[model samples]
Target: MSLAQPAPTPSRWLRAALPAMFILLGVIYATWASRLPAIRDLRVLDAATLGTILLGGGLGAVLSFPLAAWLLAHYGARRAALYAGLGLLFGLPLLGVLPNWWLLFAGVFVLGAASSCFDVAINAIGAEQEREAGRSIMSMLHAWFCVGTFSGALVGSAAAGLGLSPLWHFLLVAFVLLLMLICAYRILPCDAPDPDAGKKHFALPHGALIWLGLIAFLGAISEGSLTDWISLYLTDHLHASEAGAPLGYAAFAGAMLVARLVGDRLKDRFGARRLVAGSSLLAAVGLGVAIAAPSFGVAVIGFVLTGLGVAAVFPCLFSAAGREGPTALAGVATLGYSGSLMGPPLMGYAIHGYGYVFGMALLAVVSVFVAVAAMRARLLV
Candidate 1:
């Protein structure tokens, strides 16, 4: 199944299964993340210790770049995605059963590696599917990921509310996801491994790809910072009550969900460069407003705007990179993953030294930079 030729009409089951992979990926990731506080409390770990544990996941991802490229080159997307997905499912339950922080770090490391590998492969499949269909579907596929995250978050909240143990929650989710994967695998598209892709074990963004990576980096920082800090910001800055703090993130996520639901059509109608530039500018403004907001309600409004503004950047960027071939997409994904790894910790240090407002202000500044870069990036189409 060479991408240069229009692929055979994919089976309906294959098309359905492809999006399911993205959703399952999100469910696994969020299910683990939403349980972080619980795990910390269980182990009686301090902030620094928890941060160290989290760092393991990032390191694992970075280290897996070469391996991910190799897997995609040798095994192709279907086998690579399946193998990595199994690793993810296995790692999830391990996190729940780990006896200590060190073991937990090891589990998270495996999970992260699996996630990075799975991400690259699944996205490769999406790129292929989009090309075969002669349309843009990456945004809608990514939207399903958001759906999974939202669903996973809700499930986590319910489990927590019910006082269900993390072990039980994870086990249940993993079991269900595994069943879904089993069904999906039966119908996933088959492609022979790319012989040409074998020589490159790793990649760095070059030429126009460098700009695409830059956009991904800044966008990731903005997204990651909000996920990591929004609740704390609402609680500390606005004096939001305990029960209300999570709503800030909810507003952001919900807005992103809505934006992505419409993102593909918007991309087709307006072109990637124009849409990205305008949306990034909106994100900058929204983040600035949120950082300076006098009240919680105002902050939530800002977050909503930020979400709406930044939603289309990745799907567009990923689709563009996919056009460049597997290596390019892998390179962009690697760079973007690095930003996700570095953003929160860097912001933590900044906030500790300066203040919360200072840290968030930096994110807003980057959002503006994203806007400017998008306008100048001609190849983003």
Candidate 2:
């Protein structure tokens, strides 16, 4: 093959291995997220402190953008993914075994950094595959991520109910993820270094990308806040049982999984802008309902709606970014992921001062911003 020819996409292995990797990614994140209440109880941390610790993870994610770019440039997507994945598998157990919340903050920071880096690598490969096949598949791949989180949340609920220690639970999940990672390492497409990666290490979103980033920013705040706080809200505010607390996130992830499974079709039918605008509005409504819920069951129904509402936002936005090329995609993704991962810790302070009600309400308001931003986004199609 001529050097001018782009890398050949993988065979059927891409279909099988890539989605499994996304699922594993989701599982790893949800394993820790679903168990936040237990960790809080173990560390005897208040909301403020827990939020501070969670901030470390968000900081790590934001800071990893350059590192991710550097790695993808030097090593290629597969090894970048492998390295980050190993970092996560190694770091997660530390969250469970840490001596205190202070130490836990350090571990979570590393976790976030690795998680975001892995995400960038995986999406980079997925975009390449989609471009090569001349089709749409980003949504489907992200659907698998939703599947992983849903499954992880359910398993976490069971573990918490069984009175399993966080250390043991993390270890078991990490082992399973390791097996999945091994398989993925062998089958995933071998995209070479991004040709322009060196020059674009610190690229920032601009023009249309800024609008797309805005949508991602608000969408992520809603998504991340719920992932990090919804269960705790169930437990502390609604007085849910240990087993039942995680059900809130399970509902969210499950609903998102179902929606994302069909997200490509929906995006094709309605168009990206319409789908995002409508979905953001739906998320706002659903989150409002959840916040106002009088009982745990009622709150779960709201979370389900919220899940359905936000499901299409990321996939639609990311796919749009892909059309703009990898550099733009990376820039928008960095901005978005930073918000999604980092915004939650910031919300902790608000929740600490005013309460969970305020925190949830703030997210509901932000969902409106997502809708408005999507409506205005010129790059969405």
Q: RMSD of each candidate?
A: 4.0, 3.2
| Model 1 agreement with the true structure over 16-66: per-residue lDDT tens digits | 888899889878856765566567668886555655666667777778867
Candidate 1, position 95, lDDT: 88
Q: Tens digits of per-residue lDDT for model 2 on 191-231?
A: 67877765766577898789998888788878888888888
Instruction: Find the candidate with the highest TM-score and give its number.
Output: 2
Q: Global CA lDDT of candidate 2, please?
A: 0.86
- TM-score, predicted candidate 2 vs. hidden true structure: 0.95
Which residue pairs collide in model 2, if any?
none
